[model samples]
Every structure is written in C-alpha cells, then in structure tokens.
Target: MAYDIPPDLAGMNLLEIAEQVQARKLPPVDTWKPESTSDSRMRIAADGTWYHDGSPVTRPAMVRAFASLLWRDPADGQHYLVTPHYRQTIEVEDAAFIATDMRDDDGALAFRLNTDELVIAGPDNPLRAEGDPDAPSIYLAVRHGCEAKLDRSTWMQLAEFALERGGDDLAVTSQGETFSLRPSA
Candidate 1:
C-alpha cells in the first residue's frame, strides 16, 4: 500500500509540530491496573507489521487503535494491550513501533511512526542506540514505556542531519539533548 506523508507535517517547523503533538491525547494505558492477563494472539513484526493468528493485519486504522492501547509491563518487560478490564500480552519482535520518517526543525527532531503518530525527541521522549555496534538500532521513546525504532531510511536521514551539524561523535541534538547514533563500545 502507498503511504502518503501527512500534509500538515510535510513542511512544518518545530513550533508547528509541537502544537500538533500536544493536541493529541493518548489513552491512559499506564494508569490502568488490569488483573486478568492472557495472550492477545497478536504479534508486532520487526518490520513494523502487525499480525494476528499469523496473518497480517491489513487495516491501518486497526493497527493504530491497537497501538493506542499498548503498554509495557515493568515487572516482566512484556508488551500488553491494556484496558480497564484485562491485560492481553502481545509478542513484539523488536520495537512496538517503527519510526517511518523523520523531520528536523532547528534542534528539535520530530519522528513519524508507522502508526502515523508524531513524537518529538526531547527530555520526556529521549533517543537511544542499542544492539550491535556495526549495525546499531536507534530507538525513540514513545508513550507507555514503548519505543519506536528508526527504519533504515530514517536512520540514514538522521545520520546525514547529524553530519551536517559537524559533530566529532556520531550524534544529533534534539530539544537540547545530544543522542549518539552508535552504541557505546
């Protein structure tokens, strides 16, 4: 399926993106304490594809809806779909979301997720690089202890953006915080 870039974010600056980001109210999945737990029979593939019963979930809207309810258990480090009633576990091969695109407005970096969620890299939502040093994965902290891994193209874009800033270390500054693209050796 062809995915068109959201028109509003196409040429938006930091301030514009900030305003839109604040306007979005996510579900309070973190606050809920659901006792009942079970397998969701769902899986979020490493490539950011959602699956159920081993079948790909084709609807973007459904994926977005499920994403809104996603939360990570601090005790077991498991991903769950939390509601007021129950907590259903879901398999996450890598990150729950993928940073499909990135935009740099001055020092602030805005990332667009596979679910079309906009997240600005700042103190609240920090960036981290993990995994192998040769091919490290860069992730941005989304909500409810979930993170969005930067896709290959987005990672390349961020690297180029960082390079233009003339940094000795492979790093990028967003919202006054410098994030390293390579894992610490």
Candidate 2:
C-alpha cells in the first residue's frame, strides 16, 4: 500500500497545505481498522519534541512524514501512527504537537503548530484551557481529534487577543463565536 500526499496538496509547503487541509476532505482514517499492531518506540515529549528509541528525531521532514500517519483511536482513546497494513502505538507526553506560533486570521485565532500545520480556531477547530487556574494548559484542536498544546509563549500571545466579555470573562472571538478562556475580576 502506498501512502501518497493528495495531488492537490502535493508540492505545497506546510503552511500552504494547511489552508487547503482546512477545506479538503481527509482520508477516512477513523474507518480504517487494521489488526496488526506493534510498538513504534516513538514518543512525543510534552514540549512537542519527537524521540525515537530515546534519540531525538530532529529532521523536520521525517517528523512530518510520521505525523501524516497519526490517528486517534476513538475506541481506546489512544493515539497511533497508522498504515493500511499495521498500527504502531506511540507515546504522547501531553499532546501530539504544540502551537508554536499564533496570529489573527480574519476574525479567528490561527495557530502555526510545531508540525507547521496551521489551524484557524473555529467551532470545528476550537481552543480550550485546562489544568490549574494560575498555570492553565491551553490546547488547540488541529484536526478531527488531534490537539496541540500551546506553550507559555503562545499562550501569552493568545492572551493579547482576549477581550473582556460579559463583565469579567476573558473571551476570544473566533469565527464570530466567543469562547471564554477564563473568568477575570
């Protein structure tokens, strides 16, 4: 089985392809249920670093190649790198990726992830917060169920976009809908 990039997305850089991906139909990865399984020895660190067998996979292209095969198993709620013939279980420390950069896109918050994939925060691709109130963990949905954790720098940058809504809520409007990041006094 050959895994090929879509002809429309072929030859395009990550940022250019990301915009297309926002509209393009994805291969039905959720429907692909392969029986073969193996340990990949690939781990994504909390900081969005990829390591293979304890060594860092420093090559961006190689990391992107593997990222293309990533899938989240709804049945088990685990992430895997899937192929037509096999599935490899990979460890994720926090999220599969990180939001390395952020900016305003139209009226939405657009994120450039470590994978170079850009995501415009909307109802389909929303941003949310978790963890401690003092040190919240921000996460952005990149695709179907794949999420990217926002690092402190990106989080701070996102805060600059926040507006006070309904008196004391720190909310950001994306695609016309306001999502609250936190409550403020």
Candidate 3:
C-alpha cells in the first residue's frame, strides 16, 4: 500500500509544524506493561537510519509507526518497541531519533526529526550537549524517554542561532529555559 508522505518541514512554518505535532496522537507505549520479551533484530544506526535484519527500512510511514511504539527502559538502559502484548528489544547505536532540521520560532527552537516528527525545545523537552567540547553532540529530549541528536546541519544552524543572540557564553534560551551548548568540563 502506498502512503502519503508528510509535507516537508522546509515548506511549513513553525506554527503549522507545532499544530501538526499537537494534533497527532501516538500509542500509549508508556502505559503498556508487557510480560513477553524478545529481540527484534532491528537496529537504529547512529545516523538515524532504521534497519531490520540488516536491511534498511525506507518507508516513512513504517518508520513513523515503529517510532511511535518506541520506549527506553530505564532499568536496563535499552530501547524497546513496547505493545500491550509484548516488548521487543531493539539496538540503538547512538540516539533513537535524529533532528534533521531546525527553525527558530519566535524565541523558541523547533526541530524536525528524520521521521518528520516536530519537537519544540523547552523545559519539558530540553537540549543537552555531550561528547567533546571541540565538537559536541547536541541532543534534544523527545517523548517516551527518547532523544534526538542534532544532525550536522541542524547543529550548525543551532550554532548560528546562538551566535545571533550575541553572548560570550555559548548558550541559548528557548521557552523559558537556557541550554549551554558547550559541554560541561
């Protein structure tokens, strides 16, 4: 079956994107308490590509559907696809999602993930800088204890946005929260 791909983020304004995000409803994986467990043999690469049985999943709809069921188990620090019936462990090399695009919405920061999901950075969903100070890997907290790593272009865009704010410290404020892009020493 053919699926209608979601509109490209570049064509939509922040408000429209935010509206879409708010309108969409996802499965309540958090509420699921499944007793059965198994290995999915699915792997999410560090670059945000999803692969099953060593084959890439190229369908946007399929990716989005699977992503909605994703959950990170705090006890084992492992990613899983949870359903009411069972929970299947999946491999994640880096982050589960990748922030492929970003835009400034008023004083806030908005991001578009590789799965075409929209996210706003704020108190509930915050930004964090990790890895080396010279080249940090910035991440945005997504739902269900998942995070989206800012891709190279998005990271550059964030740096430009931070520079526009003109602060000696490499920091940016969004939605009443301040995030330091420089990794903590």
Candidate 4:
C-alpha cells in the first residue's frame, strides 16, 4: 500500500493552519494497533521542529497532521504516529510542542502552544520546572499525556509572575492555588 504525503504548506500562516486543524476531529488514534518500528530519521527536536529523513519538515499542515496521529505507547515508553497499518517511532528530544504565549486569565494562567492549542494551568493541567537551576525549562501538560515546553520568553514571564508573589522560592499561582516553579531556597 502507498501513502499520499501531504504537500508543502510553505505559504499558509499559523492561524490558517490552526483553523484547518481545529476544524477537524482527530481520528481515534488511541485505538490503532500496528507493529511498532523505530524510525531513525524522523524526529521532533527540542525546539518543536519536525524532521524526516534528516531534513527539517517546515510544513505546518504536515506537522499538524502528524501531531494528530501521535500516540504514546505505555509498554515501550515512546511516542508514535500510529495508523491502522503502521506505527513509526519518532525521536522526541523534549516535549512535542512549545508554549509560545501565556495569559493570566483572571488569576489562572493559560498557555498557548505552537500548535495554537490553549492549555489552562490548574490542578488538572500542571506546570513543572525541569533542568538545572541556572537554566530551567518549564513544561506544561497540554493534552493526552503530551507536554508543551515553554519557550525562554514564556518561562521568563512565568518566573517574573512568580516573583511578583513575594516568595523565597519561585512560584506561580493559578485558580487560587500556587505551584512552585522552583524549589525553595
């Protein structure tokens, strides 16, 4: 069988891509069962760039399409873009998407992802600080066991917001509750 690869999405802007993707309901990817195989060349870099055959996949539509097909296998602890017939392993250096923007929605923080998906930081959707203290990176649960890494600017904004709370350690508040972005000094 053959697969029709999506065309170049070089011209469509982010909003157009978001609209296109959001309008469609994702297929039931969780139910797909296929023989898992490692795909050495396809990867999702830490910066949220997708690559195939060792080249950057710059097409927005293609990325969105592939992202929709992503499924996390509990047995192997890896991510795959699954179909009824095939499951291809993808190297994800970090979280699949980046939180590009943040909004303080009435004391609750809302994160906007690179894919234009909005995730509200709360009890259910939580944020975690990872990596070294000198260079910490923030991650938030975006959806379906997938996390979105916060870009440097967004993390800085979150840190600043945390500082405004007047604490010895880094912390941010959402929905009248507080979450520590960094450990207490």
How would you encode candidate 2's per-residue C-alpha lDDT over 11-118 as one tens digit per residue? Answer: 455466446656744456666788999999999999889999999999998998888788977677688888777899999889998987776645666777788776
For all candidates, what are the clash counts?
A: 0, 0, 0, 0
TM-score of 1: 0.93
lDDT of 1 by residue, 1-185 (tens): 23344676777888888888899888899999988999999999999999999999999999999999999877888999999989999999999999988887787999999998899998899999998977889999999889999999888888878778886788988899988988877
Residue 33 error, candidate 3, Å: 0.8
Candidate 3 lDDT by residue in tens digits, 96-160: 99998787767788888988788989998999999999899999999989999999988988998
Better of 2 and 3 by lDDT: 3
Best by TM-score: 1
lDDT of 4 by residue, 1-185 (tens): 22221232323444554455357587787877777565746888999999999899988888988888887667766888788888888888898889877756457777667776666787877888777777777889755567899998788778777767787877888766678786334
Model 2 off-target regions past 4 Å?
1-20, 23-27, 163-167, 183-185
When sorted by TM-score, best at the front, the candidate numbers are 1, 3, 2, 4
lDDT values, one for every candidate: 0.90, 0.75, 0.90, 0.74
Q: What is the lDDT of residue 126 in candidate 1?
A: 92
For candidate 2, list the clashing residue pairs, or say none.
Answer: none
Candidate 3 at residue 32, lDDT? 96
RMSD of 3: 5.2
Candidate 1 lowest-lDDT run of ten: 1-10
Which residue runs of candidate 1 sit more than 4 Å off their true CA positions? Answer: 1-7
